[model samples]
Target: MRIGMIGCGVISQQYLASFDQLPDVQLVAVADLDPARAAAAAEGREGVRALSVDELIADPAVDTILNLTIPAAHADVDLRAIAAGKNVYSEKPFAVTTKEGAEVLVAALAAGVLVGSAPDTVLGTGTQTARAAIDEGLIGSPIAATATMVTPGHERWHPQPDFYYTPGGGPLLDMGPYYLHALVTLLGPVASVIGAASRTRDVRTIGSGPRAGESIPVSTDTHVTGVLVHESGVLSTLVMSFDAVATSAHPIEIHGTEGTLAVPDPNRFSGDVTVHRLGGEGWEPVPTAGGYEEAGRGIGLHDMAVRGPELRASGELGQHALEVMNAVLESAHSGARIEIASHVARPEAVALEDVRAAT
Candidate 1:
């Protein structure tokens, strides 16, 4: 797959690094609203051209678009790419709204182009191993789960922290995809959700970079909690916050009749998956049992490149997760349980294997 990466931001660095290790993908072109950033990204890379965003999308040599743009631009970029007869792999949340996300998927489907989304972190060994444990009945009859992600705020470190506080940039929307995607992967599609949310302040002061001390207005929920009723009847509790100081809780914990599974943070590619049997003494480390070993951000794109329709981090799953999240927020505002209209099968598992060799 020849990739034309549409946003040259901090996250793009990880994908660029992974492209070198992935034989199935090629970084053919790069683009960003900031032309200089695009040029810098292409510097010293063999045969990589830095083109305008429009030029890159129109470039017939590019088979797929790696849309790393801001959340607000996700669906637009994806739709444009699909219209140009190119496949798309977008960064998370799918889109700012469920309507927009659905539009992107519908367009891609009609165009006969593949669509994939990020938070592919689930395709990594950490979450995959936990799934394997449940599948193997180490944790029999899955019952419930708890997912927690808390931080003081992204303003503490993100250079351009304005977007983190906007409509599409709150704690749940910005960071929930990783956890939600993992939950669906471990449990199943969510059937309904009830959520409550709060924001501590109206503005956040930037704590780093040239914008230090600059305050950005907040228009979205900062601390979001919800109960996700999975289709399988498992209830997952979620707590996503940008107003918290710290936490010692495991990123995710799945409880079942036989045992419990401790899942690693879904933001990364790897971690130790520990399991505690019902009658066992303590948590024991589960051997890596599934997913691409030593994977990275672009592994989903590689999965799409290799698996075609069988790709795990597919747009259907992405849109389903996106709708589930939006429903959570809507439920918060309406004070009612929101029913999810979308459903997706849990993606196929990746047996423990070196991604580098697969390519």
Candidate 2:
């Protein structure tokens, strides 16, 4: 599959690094609102052209669009790519709103194009190994889960951190995708959500980059906590915060009738998956049993190329996750439980294999 990458920002570098490792996909073109950024990405690569966003989307040689644009532009870019008769794989959060996310899916279906989304990190060894252990009954009948992500703030490091404080870029919307997607992958679709949120300050001072010493206003919640009641009757508790410094808690922990499983960070591609049995003394490492070994960002696009419509990191799942998150925020302010209108079947498990073998 020939890919046309539409954003040349921080995350694009990760995808570019993995393109050579993925045998099923190749980068042919790149685009950005800034022509200089696009040119920089295409510089050292062969057979890659820097083009305007419209020209790249309409290019006949490009079969798929790898959308790395910001949250607000995700749906718009995807719709345009679908109109151009190309598949689309976008970054996390799907879109700023569920209504927009649904529009992208409806249009893609009508156009006979595939729509995929990120946080495919779940397809990596960390989450997949934990999944295999659960399926193997190491955790017995799954009962509940807890997912936690916390950081003091992103302004300390990110060059341009204004978006992190905006409405579509809160802790829940910004960092929730990785944890929520992983939870759904381990548990199932969320049936209902109840949430409570808080923000510490109205203005944040940038600590790094050219924007250092600049103050950005915070218009969104910085600390978010919620309960996701899965359709399978499993209860997954979530805590995502930009207000806290750090925590010793595992990124995710699943408890069952017989034991508990500690899952690695879903934002990453690989880590140690450990299990503590009911009769066991200490946490034992679960052997790597599934997913793409040594994979990275573009592995999801590679999976899309090989599996076509059955791609696991699907927009359906992304949309469901987005809806769940938006509902959580709504519930936070409304003081009521919100029911999810969208659902997605659990993706097929990927058998463990070399990254290049996906071809």
Candidate 3:
């Protein structure tokens, strides 16, 4: 897979670093709204060059587009790449709206091109190991889960945090994908959702960078809590907040009739998975049993590269997660439980392996 990365922002750095380990992927070109940024990213990288967004999208050498653009541009970039008969892998939230996300999927299907999305973090050992235990019935008869993420705000660390407060941004849309994707992997697709949300202020003061002390407008919910009723009859409680200070809660926890599983954060590639059996003394660590060892961001591209349309981090899953999220927000506003119209098969469990060797 020859990749033309369409954004050179902070998130792009992780993907760039991931490329060296992903033998199945070749980042042939990079583009950013800021030409200097794009050029800098390509510098000293053998055979890689910087091009305008247009040039990169049209470049025949690039068969796949790594759409690292902001949430607002996700659908547009994907549509363009699909129109050009190229596969696309986008960042989280898929698109700003459910309609745009659906359109991107329909276009990809019509064009016979592939689409994948972020939060592939679940394909790593951390989440995958827990998934393995669940499948093996270590935690028999899965019943419920709780996922929680809280922060003062991204404005404290991110140099450019404006997008974190916009329409397509916010705690649920920005950070929810990681938790949502993991829940789907551990449980299954959501059947319906009920939600409530709150925003503390209308603006945020940037804490660092050249724009430090600058205030940005807030146009979305900062704290979002919801209950996702999975198709498997499991209930997962989700709390995503940017307004809070901190917490001691595990990132996620899965409960079952026999036992419970402690899942690590889904934002990264790996972590320890612990479980307590029906009569166990305490929570015991589960040995890593599945997923790519020492994996990173672009592993999804490698998965897509090898699996083609059967890739685990698929656009269909992304869109389903997206709809589940938007419906939560809609439920928040309407004070009603929203039924999800879309459903996606749970992604296949990853067998324990080294990604570098697979390529």
Candidate 4:
């Protein structure tokens, strides 16, 4: 597959490396609003040519277009790629709103092209091992889940982090996808959501980087809490914050009738997983058979290496997560529990022996 990258930012480096490692994929071209940035990313890359967004999408040589643009531009770029009859693999928070994500999905379906989004972290070792254990009935029937993320703000290292406080880059849209994807992967589609959100501080001071000590006015909600009712009757409490501090806790925990499974942070691809049985006094770590040692590369590469298909942790999961998170925000805004319109079934489990046989 000839892949064209739309944005050449920090995350794009991971995509570039993963695509380069794949024997079936070729990084044919790249596009960025900043010509210099695009040129820099294309440097030393074989067969990579920097082009304008339009040119890259319209190019017949490219089979897939990776949409790595900022959150606000996701829908527009995806629509264009679909119109050009190209498959799309986009970054997380597929769009600023579920409505926009729906439009993109419709376009891709009409165009007869596959559309997927990031937060493919589920394909990572941490979430994948958890899924395997759940499939084996190690945790039995999940009854509840909780995910918490508290960050000081991205102004620290991001060269252009101002957009993070904007609508498309808030905590719910930005970091919510990872945890939400893991939840949906472990459980199933969320049936309803009730949420509350607020901006604790009007401005924040940058903690590090060249912008250190600089004040940034916040425009979007920085603190959000939501209760998600899954179709499987699992109630999940999700919390995100930019104004507070949090102690060490598994980013996600799923409680089941037979046992409780504690998953590592969902932000990265691979980590340790533990399960505490109903009668057990302490948590016991579940040994992972096919876990990756690296972080971001694990999920994407594992999907490609193990499944021989892109859907493993591919862009599709990211799009689904985007819809779920947007539903939470919408529910918060209307002061009512909102039901997500999209339905994403939990993936079927693949046996480790089968995976080994294929390998």
Q: Which prediction has the highest lDDT against the true structure?
A: 3
Q: After superposition, how far is residue 191 of candidate 2 from its true place, in Å?
A: 0.7
Tell me the tens digit of each residue's lDDT in model 1 across 257-325: 999899999998799999899899999999999988999899998899889988999999989988988
Better of 2 and 4 by lDDT: 2
Q: Put down candidate 4 lDDT per residue, 1-359, tens digits, no spaces.
A: 67888998888888776654444456889999999989998999878999998899999999888888999999999998998898887787888877788889888778877776677666667887898888788988888999999887677667667878989878889899888888888887788889988887888777767777788888888889999999888899999887676647679998898989999888876788998999999989998744443434323433443354335554455667777787777777889878777677675543332222222
- List CA RMSD, all candidates: 0.8, 0.9, 0.8, 2.8
Taken over the whole model, the C-alpha lDDT of each candidate is: 0.93, 0.93, 0.95, 0.78
lDDT order, best first, reads 3, 1, 2, 4
How well does model 1 score by local distance difference test? 0.93
Tens-digit lDDT track for model 2 on 9-113? 999999999998898899999999999999999999999999999999999999999999988899999999999999999999899999999999999999999
Per-prediction TM-score to the true structure, in the order listed: 0.99, 0.99, 0.99, 0.91
Model 3, runs deviating above 4 Å = none
243: Cα error in model 3, Å: 0.9
Q: Worst 10-residue stretch by lDDT in candidate 3? A: 350-359
Clashing pairs in 3: none
Q: List the residue pairs that clash in candidate 2.
A: none
> Which sections of candidate 2 miss by over 4 Å?
357-359
Query: Taking the tens digit of each residue's C-alpha lDDT, what string does model 3 give over 1-359?
Result: 99999999999899888899897789999999999999999999999999999999999999999999999999999999999999999999899999999999999999999999998999999999999999999999999999999999999999999999998899999999999999999998999999999999998999999999999999999999999999999999999999999989889999999999999999988999999888989989999999999999999999999999999999999999999999999999999999999989999999999988855
Which pairs clash in model 1?
A: 291-350
